[model samples]
Target: MFTHRIDSATYLKLLEVQDSEKLFQLIDSSREHLRNWLPWVDKNTTVEDSRQFIQHTLDQFAAGNGFNAGIWYQGALAGVIGFHKIDWQNSTTSIGYWLGEDYTGNGIMQKAVSKCLDYAFLELRLNRVEIRSAIGNVRSRRIPEKLGFTLEGTIRQAEKLVYGYVNHNVYGMLLEEWEAKENSSTYDDETYE
Candidate 1:
């Protein structure tokens, strides 16, 4: 039930049964927006497929494995952001996110990511979070960079893309580093915009 609203246009929250309707709507609208970047999203994916996907995500959250939040813009569904492959033993997690095409370039995703990272480090008490983006995905790479994440390295042929397997640039941020930035007098919250 945790929820956050930003700028009267965007929202982030834990998914619920009531969200299924909105979730379906978002998927239908997002198929074309995401079809290029996310290989998993197809124009033909059914509502049932999206439901099962959301159900799996919720189940993972309930099992203490991870968390996923729906992103809503201007009271309409946008996309999603989530933490996955969390290793509690190591206090680490990976961030995954996508924005509906219409909502891109408006700084909404940047703000949403800032809030998610804040929650992950300050509230969830995670030590490190990693973000990996396909080598050519400049937009995706920009999120971690804007959030002050360090560019760790590139994993050659790390993941398969729509075209084929490609190298991934890995980036990471540590809790200590985030805390230092947050506590710094020069740090500007407005930068997230």
Candidate 2:
């Protein structure tokens, strides 16, 4: 299993079957809040559903497609962040993430995302990474912006949530861009919070 320590109190661990109950509980607790932006929230109605989702992540990892990791903040499940899939032919991948409503305003997602970008560019040696957020999701949009991703474009009707179809703003960062950001950043992990 892949585990990354962001700080003393924050880390990301690969999801496993044993995590179903905790994952489901977190999702259930934040259902209404998550339903606003995520389409899969309602579909995950039980622990079994969460187990299946974790199994799928395992399969994806085995297939070398990508992975989903649970964000553990201060020893609690705070959210999830993952690569949707790796397009090896293009040397790129897109990241998707969601944090429980209670976990908002903590800079957890931002730091987790920054770590993912580091992995993508430094470890995986990927050419590009992308993040797409619904137009109305200001919080989600800010993550990539704060991380220095360039606004690529908008895809109309990119995703359908509970409300209706929503436009997506695509943000991308190339390997060179990430390297530049890393070399120039004055803020360390300790000060990021």
Candidate 3:
């Protein structure tokens, strides 16, 4: 089921078939806002599409490759965050995330990401994690930066959105660095609950 509570009002839950309608509604309402950065927004036009997406994430979890989860805030589905895929050989993975327009500016994504990092390092014992953001997506870039990831570099035209190709700014954090930061900071105990 994979639920991690971030606070009294927010948590991350693994998407399920029953969540399809809510997920689709949120995406439909946030279409214009999300379309700017998310390439699959246009393709996800129905509850069926969302169901298929959730099924795929469930399969990913089962395969032990990675996972995608819905960001539930104040009892509503606000967005999604997940590891694109894990490179077990290299002990590395890249995260991808997005928030609905109404859910921004509350530090929700940052907290969710921190919890995922805890899971990656302490639970999974992964060595490194990365987050790649479109160059112009300031909000997305801010999450990893606030969490103390180092700016690795930019990959030119790394992804193709509906409009065109976009450059991606890569941010990376090593497990050692995360451990040091956690030791020095006031991190909470709400991980993998």
Candidate 4:
């Protein structure tokens, strides 16, 4: 696994044991901010639960199912972003992420997502990636949009939140599309200058 360091912040491949403490910190720090979007936080799950979760993620990574990268900002654990429910046969994957409340709106998540997407498309050879945001989650929805993902559609009551089932807006981006955008942007910049 590759450990990526950007702007002095490292994105390390998560370990089951060594990473558990940081995972707990992330959970505790984001509890209030996450409660509205993620129901799992409402359970008030323990650090042991995070250990189990880390174990599951590591197992999945080992089995070639998916990969989760821990985001460290300024040498402290800040959040996590991952490719889950990976379908290699279908050339597709889903991207999920969360950040500590304090790190919100600082472009850290954007950088993390960009790095993960590069890994997925270039290293893993994935064709497409998807991001689903709960309806009305402006901040969450903006991630995919900022990355040039196309809004595919909305799934009504697609996810069950703490309150109840809620609609989700599905966004998708293809590797080819990303590459084209990358190339075009370079040309556009040259032309503008």
- lDDT of every predicted structure (CA atoms): 0.80, 0.92, 0.91, 0.79
Error of 2 at 91 (Å): 0.4
- Runs in model 3 deviating more than 4 A are 186-193
Q: Model 2, stretches more than 4 Å misplaced?
A: 186-193
Candidate 2, residue 54: lDDT: 99
- Residue 59 in candidate 1, Cα distance off native in Å: 0.6
Candidate 3 lDDT over residue span 49-146, tens digit each: 99999999999999999999999999999999999899999999999898888988777888899989998999899999999999898888888887
TM-score of each: 0.89, 0.96, 0.94, 0.90
Residue 15, candidate 3: how far off, in angstroms? 0.5
lDDT (tens digit, per residue) of candidate 2 on 1-193: 7899988899999999999999999999999999999999999999999999999999998898999999999999999999999999999999999999898888888889988988899999999999999999999998888888899999999999999999999999999989988977543433332
Candidate 4 global TM-score: 0.90
Prediction 3 TM-score vs. true: 0.94
lDDT of candidate 1 over 119-191, digit per residue (tens): 8899989999999998888888888887789999999988765678888899999999989887652324444
Report the lDDT of model 1 for residue 61.
88
Q: 115 in model 4: Cα distance from truth in Å?
A: 0.9
Instruction: Give per-residue lDDT, candidate 4, residue 102.
Output: 84
Considering every candidate listed, which one attains the maximal lDDT?
Answer: 2
Top TM-score model:
2
User: Considering lDDT, which of the candidate structures 1 and 4 is the better prediction for this target?
Assistant: 1
Put down candidate 4 lDDT per residue, 1-193, tens digits, no spaces.
6477655654655655677877887888789888888877756478888887888888888888887778888878888888877997999999998888887777777667777777788888899999999987788887888778899999999888877898999999899987787655321212110
Candidate 4 wrong stretches, greater than 4 Å: 10-12, 183-193
